[model samples]
Structures are given as C-alpha cells and as structure tokens.
Target: MAGFWLGPRAAMRGYRLFGYDSIGSTSSEAMASARRGDAGDVWFAALQQTEGRGRRGRVWESPSGNLAASLLIVHEGDAASVATLGFVAGIALQEALSGNLPASALRIGVDGADGLTGQGHAARLALKWPNDVIADGGKLAGILLEAQGLPDGRMAIVIGFGVNIVAAPTGLPYPATCLHALGTPVSAEAVFAALADAWVDAFELWAGGRGVADVLARWRRHAAGLGSEVAISHDGQVVRGIFETIDEFGRLIVRDGARGTIAITAGDVHFGATATSGRT
Candidate 1:
C-alpha cells in the first residue's frame, strides 16, 4: 500500500486506485471519474473528507486519520440488482476489520462498538442492518451507495465506506468507536489496505447479484438486532416490532403484534432501548 495499491486480487481484476490526503468526498470523485468516461472499476480513497455525507443527507465526518473510500463500478443491469452490493460491502468491511482488529476484539461476538476498551477482554463484532458495522451497539463504520445513469444504458455505481480508524465523531445520536478508542490503534492507510483487498473477496462472492443469496446468508450470520426490539421511523410513522429477518431482496422485515409482517423498504431504524426513546 505504499502508493495505495489494492490487494493482489483486486489488482489482478484490473481494479485501479486513486489516493488523496484530503478530499471533499471520495464518492463524489468516483462519480466524477465515471462522468469523465474513465472506465470504472476504480477506488477513490482519502484520509480526510471535508464534505462527506451519509444516508438521508446527514453530514459524515472524516477527519484526518480516518478512512474514506469509494469504489466505482460501471455496471450494466437493473438498479435493483446493484442494490445488493450494500450487503456485499458490509460483509467486506466486517471481514477486513475482523482481520485487522486486535485479537482481544475477535472474541465470540462484539455486543457493541461505542465506548469500548481493549482492557484485556474480548469483543464481538456485528452489522447493524443495511449498512453499518458495530461492536455491541456502537457504530464503527458506515456505507453509502450512490448511482448515476450513463448514456450507454449502463450505470456508475459508487459504494462508499467511512470508517473510524484513529478518531470517531462526537455527539452522534448513537455511540461511535474507533480502533484507537478500542485500544487497537491502527493507521487509516492500513485499514484501507486491508479493506481494498477484502472487497475483492466479498464482491466475488456476490458475483454481481447471482450469488446474493449467499451474501445475504453471510450477512445474517453477523447481523445485529435480528431478534431484538426495533423501531423504524418513516414518513412520520413509527413502526415498532421485533427485528425479524431480512427478505430475500434484503429489505428489512419487521414482525409487529397488530400489524402482522411489515417489509420496510427504507427508514431510520433504532434498536432496543433506543427504539423506544422517541427519536428517529
């Protein structure tokens, strides 16, 4: 990773890389590259993102020493098919982090990610539905997916990863943790180096939507709050229920007492105690 070269597998697949010490947003850069007709299959990574954004237009902080990366793929297929890549990304991020985390954090399971310490104890790692990696209930990383149509009936899809390697943002609605905070201090570059390669493994498993079932299975194994109390806020309505399994297409399915089975296409999800906190 001297010059941000990806893992051998990625390189073999002809994937390219562009590294920056600071940038507005790696995802934005990826789309720009696509717009310029630069054949995709490239990753744009930056150490700092001054104008990063999260799902639903939330500001994503990417201070120096954190990892902000976006992978652009020039894809020809239905947009629905490409959406499954989000799960693929969660799997890759988990695999990369599990490989890079301190052995102490590689225990049977990580219950939460926030305010954790590596004080001679093991931790569990899990994925919060859709696009987040967590230790216990604390958020360690997040994913954002974006797509733009090209004139050739194809699309430029960018899946972005923002990880807290050295520092986590403050005052978020939920807890945020970083490698340093977990006592497994590591450089953002090192994380990206591992993540770049891990993406190859997970992406291959996905096989461009053909193997999504397997991806979904792996995702389920590491999913958090699957059988826990949950709340989803959508369009001024709050749906409270048990965190049921995700449907085949990856939509979250909630089992409500009086509402039968509810399939949530998109919404802000909260779990356990937070679900009843009257917040979206």
Candidate 2:
C-alpha cells in the first residue's frame, strides 16, 4: 500500500489523508478513523482490499490494481446533500477517466452482462441511480455511504468507492467491464490521484449549499434510463413505472400504474424489460 499523508497540509486544507497498503475495506478503515475522533475530511486509500463490499452487503471485487478508498467527512450539510453521494462520486469518476482517455468521451453506462466487453473499442459506460457505475452494461464501480453523528452534534459521512481499473472479475451476477477491456490502461496511483482531486471538487460544490436540482440535471445528461420503463423497489414494495425525472430531494420520479406518479426516496432501481436489469 502507498502512504500519502498530507497531515497538516491537508488538515489545514480541511482534509486529512491516510493511506494503507492492504485492508479489509477502506470504508471500514475510514469508520475506524472517525471513531478515534479523527474528524473533518479523513481519506483512507488502500492499495489492496481484502474485503470490499457494496450495497445489500454484496461482495465488491477489489484486486490490487484497482482503486479502493473511502473519505470520512464531517460536514454541516442537509440530508439532501448527504443523500446525493452517488452523484458526487459519479462526477468524480467521470472526470478521473477523462484525464486518461482524452480522445474517448467517457460517459457512464449500465451493465448488461457479467464479464462482457464492448464491441470493438467503443465502451458504453453508464451511471445507475443512487451510485452504481456501469460499463458495457455491467458494474464497473460502486459507491457506498455511511454516516454517523459526532460528539459535537455534527455528521461524519463516509464515502467509499471501489473502481475496476485493471481488470473486471469474471462470473458476477451481471455483466462487468473494466478500463483495460475498454483499451485504457492506467496505474493505480494515477487513478487514485485523479479521483481524489475530482472528489474534492465535487464535495466542495455540494457542500456550498447549492440545490440538488443542478446536480440532478447534470446526472440526467449522462444518465442512461430517462424516459425508460423501470422497476423501483423500496420498503418491500416493487413499483413498476416509467422513469420521468428526479425530484428536488434526489428521489426518482416514476410514473406508475394508475398511481399517476410516485417518487421513490430510497430503493434499488432497475431498468425494466425494455432495456435490461441488474441488482441494486
């Protein structure tokens, strides 16, 4: 693992950087840092992750060559900003890949099959709502957020990101693609550095008290499922609807049967049969 402790430098800049060579999960490590009263923006980056996970406690493949890191942020922000964690991570990942694949317009895509690659050199990477990054219609990266309160009544939000940089694991539930398969090769350090810079910018923007509508607008431009039939599962009820737009609080607006339109605040959203579906 690599250590890039900017210490007072980052602390003065409002972030404390802590890196590890190997760990069970960067999110877990960042949580540990939070428990020790390491407040503010604490970033834990690892060279290799032994036990990385995503939503629903599913295993997240984190080989040595991929990027695994988590950021612990103690911020005074509303729940809306906190809930839009995926957009922040998605914007960051998009920018990070842009630096490497300058010629290719790196847009987000949904995953269609596990271990599937785009035909020829054209890579179709899509962004799924709430925080799944898909490539060639399969999962490429996932963002998991965990937040807790501090002794001072502040909130510490941990943003964990696992990206498939070098290779995509074979035999997954859905189709998975990697940067290597897309013909873009990058070192782990380079990817992490780019992501860190991008994430810092994204966090600053979100923390500035801007409405989530702007973020939603940006997401829609790169979004893959607008106007598409989808299934939103929340609170043990699965509602099938046409994806209309994103509401003010970042909830997905779905036009369901006779219900007119329903807003989904939290759940696993999957594209309906018209396109393809994947686990949340």
Candidate 3:
C-alpha cells in the first residue's frame, strides 16, 4: 500500500507526507520532527498505531486499516486563538467523512447518545464538542491537539486525527461506530484524500482567527444537541442546561434557565434525554 496520497489542495500548498504501513504514533512522529527543527506543513500517517493515544492519555486502539494521521504546522497566535484549531479540525473532518459516506446513512438527529429511535433519525454525521465526530451518536472519529513552543519563538502545533474506517474500538464511554458499520467500505486513503482538501478550505476560512464567525457558522450547521437538554462535566462539576450556542471563540454556551447562560471552555457534553445516563 502507498504510504500517503496528497489531495490537490495539499499538493498546491506544498504539504509533505510521511506514510507508514504501521507505526507507534503519528502525533509522536510530528513532535519528534518539530524538535529536530523540521519546518511544519507536513503530515504523518499510518495504517496502524501500536501505541496510539487519545485525549487525556487514554489508549487509542489503532488497529490495521484505520486512519491515524497528524499534521505539524507553524501556527502563530495567542493561546486562546490557537485553541480554536480543534474546532477547525472537527468541521473539516466531518466534511471529509460526509463526502465519503452515502447520504442515506446520515440523518440530522441526536448525536446518537441513547439511540435516536423515535425523535426522527437516529443520528447523523455530527461534530461533538472539544474534538469528536459522531455518527448515529457513536464516536466515529476524534481529534487531538498539542502545541510546543520552539526555541526560535515559533509555535509548532500538531493536530492528530483518528478515524474509525474499517473498525471501531470497543468499551468506550460512549458508543462507537465506523464506516463499515454504516454500510460503507471506504478506505483510509480515501478518507485522508478528502480530509486533506476539506481541511484546507476550513483552515483558510478561519484566517488565523479573523474569520472565526464564518468557521463557527459551518460548525453549527451540523452540531448536535442544539436547543436540547445538555449536561456538561467540567472540573469536577456537572452543569446541566440547554444547548444554546457556541460563542465566536469556540466556547460551548449553555443556558440553564435560572442560572442564566454559562460559557464552557472545556467539558464533556451529553445531550438529549439520555444525557443523565452518559456516565463512564
């Protein structure tokens, strides 16, 4: 199998790729390259990850044939602004998956929390807060961001993406699904090709923080749990409210009626009536 294939946009932008049949971690490779003073704008991809990691250092099961990749870029911005990359990644990834999936399998419903059997479609392709892509309320893909300040005063940001194509891991907090489960046999290469192009457009729209509103508008279009019951777990506190909106800065905004509106910078969000049962 080929190591990597760059999309038209990626090629035009001079982005490089290092594809591996199997590897430890794409994100780890990106970090090592940055430390070696390699310029950014490169992608690290692999067919399998023997020691992959998820958010909060959880074990990311990267079996063979799954899509595990990372991008190393020189992103210069304040800490707050840099954090928005996660949102950008989410929108881009969702777009990529949308392009690769059949329209019939996707429907705008709950994020697939407790199974959307009655409230219309079960769950469509949606973006979860922070950095998760869901289909039918099960986690389809995830994004992880890490930043390192270089000695040259530049910031190297590595954005990692893991998509469940042929298979989805088991025993997760929430449910999990893959392309095959949705009746699609898409390959990792195909997914990466679409993602390479989608990310370019999304990133350009972000415009280094100048076009946040535009970027967020696209995100809201496919966001789940809007106007529904939402429970956010943050910093040892559980906050319940209605899913209001995401602010321009990418904060999850929840309205709790009596407590008014709350802006959440980080937390685990559960929506719909099954929100109360979304415990690990």
Candidate 4:
C-alpha cells in the first residue's frame, strides 16, 4: 500500500507527518523521537500496530486497515495541566469523525442517561468523558496520552489514538463498533487527514492550557452519560455514583451517594446498569 499523505489542510498547520505500513506503536515512536532531542508537533500514523496498548497496558489490537496514530507534543507546563490535553484530543477526534460521517449516522443512545439529547450535527457525536468517542452507545474510538520528561526541561506528551474504521474487535469487555459497521465506511488516510486538521484547531484553542475552560465547555456539549449512574474503577477499588460533571482541572466529578462528589483523576468508567463490567 502507498504511504499515508497529509493534505493541504494538515500541511498548512505545520504538522510534521510520518506514515508507516506497520510498527510496534506510534506512541512509542513519538516518545523515542522526543528522547532524541527532536522538536515536537509531529504526527505518526501506521496501517497496523504490532504492540499497541491501551489504558492500564491492555492490548490494543491494530490490524491492518485500522487507524493507529500518535501526536508528539512538547509543552512546558505543570503535569496536571498538560494532562488536560486528553480532553482536547477527545473533542478533536469527535469533530474529525463527525465531519466525515453524516449527522444521522453518528447518534448513539445510552440507556438511562439524561442530558443525552443533542441538536443538529454536534448532537450526533458524543464524547465519553475524558478519552473516548461513543457512537450508537458503543465505542467507536479511544484516546491514550502518555508523557515523559525530556532532557531539555520540557515534557513530551504522546497522544495516541486507535479508531476502528473498516473493522471492530470481537470478544471485548464492552461492545465495539467501527465506522464501516455503522454505515460510514471511510479510508484510514481520509480519517487521518480530518484528524490532523481538527487537532490543529483544538491545540490552538487550548492555547497552552490557558484556554482549557473553553475546551471543557465544548467537551461537555458532546458528553455522554451525564446525569446517569456510572462506575469508575482505579487501582482495584471501584466507585459507583451519578455521573456528575467535569471539574475545573478536567477531573471527572462523580456524585457518590455516600461519599459525596468525588473527583476522579484516572479510572475506567462504565455507565448505566452495567457499571460492574469493569470496562474502560
């Protein structure tokens, strides 16, 4: 297959693009590049990944024809604030996919979730809290962010994402769906093109984390499972409560019935009656 190419939209944004037919993981490449004193703002896309991983080191199946990409961002900021980029990535991915598929084809309903209603195209694409894109109540895509300190006193964040375009995984913890299965078949290259453009817009709006308030506001508009019962598991403990809202620093606010509003920094969130599924 031909290598992936960035169109004018992505090129105009000053993103250094790299494409591969197969690799261990795009995020791994970005991290290695950062360690070698390379300047950031680079995007790595691969047709297949041999050793991709998800949150908590779960295996990420990246068969040929899926979208496995990662962006290397070198930012000078406190670790707490830089992590908010995950929210920015979620919004960018949503917009990228929504731009390619029709509005009617993107809407997914979550059982027993209020505030799930949306208007127009924005309503169809929903953000599942911190790092997921939900369609038809199933997972369409996921975002994984990893950061490491550089020798030059800077931090490099590798924003990795895997989107099921032509196929979805089977026998997973939760239901998985792909773009083609959802009636919006598209090429991995086309999706990457849109994603690059959207990433530029989202990064600019983030303004070095100064504009996170705006990012969070926009994210809430596409939020899924808001005002619904949910469970979050972290480090072997599970917290179940009402899915409240995202806090100022982008932490998930869960209104535990007994614990009262708990601010969750990292965990796998499960919604509705399936709160015990332990799926992220």
- Show model 3 residue runs off by greater than 4 Å: 106-123, 277-280
lDDT of 1 by residue, 187-256 (tens): 8877887888899899899888899999998888777777777888888999998888988999999999
lDDT of 1: 0.83
List residue ranges in candidate 4 displaced over 4 A.
105-122, 276-280
- After TM-score superposition, the amount by which residue 98's alpha carbon in candidate 1 deviates from its true location, in angstroms, is 0.9
lDDT, candidate 4, 1-280, per-residue tens: 4368775766986789889989999999999999988788899999899999998898988889999999998989999889899999998998899887665653455533323445423355578876888777778899999999987788999999999888888997776778888888789888998899899889888999899999999888788778778888889898888888998899889997787899998887788867745444
| Model 1 misplacement above 4 A | 1-3, 103-123, 277-279
lDDT of 3 at 215: 83
TM-score of each: 0.91, 0.82, 0.92, 0.92
| Per-residue C-alpha lDDT of model 2 across residues 1-280, encoded as one tens digit per residue | 4844442333556665667778899898788777788855767888779999888788888887787879888777766577787687777776666566534544444422111123334335556777877665666777898888778877788889888888788986456767777777776666777777777766566655574566666665556567777877766777787888777777788887698998887777677452334344
Q: List lDDT for all candidates, in order.
A: 0.83, 0.70, 0.84, 0.84
Question: Residue 7 error for model 3, in Å?
Answer: 0.7
Tell me the deviation in Å of residue 123 in model 2.
8.2
- When 2 and 4 are scored with TM-score, the better candidate is 4
> Which residues of candidate 2, in runs, are more than 4 Å off?
3-14, 102-123, 234-236, 272-280
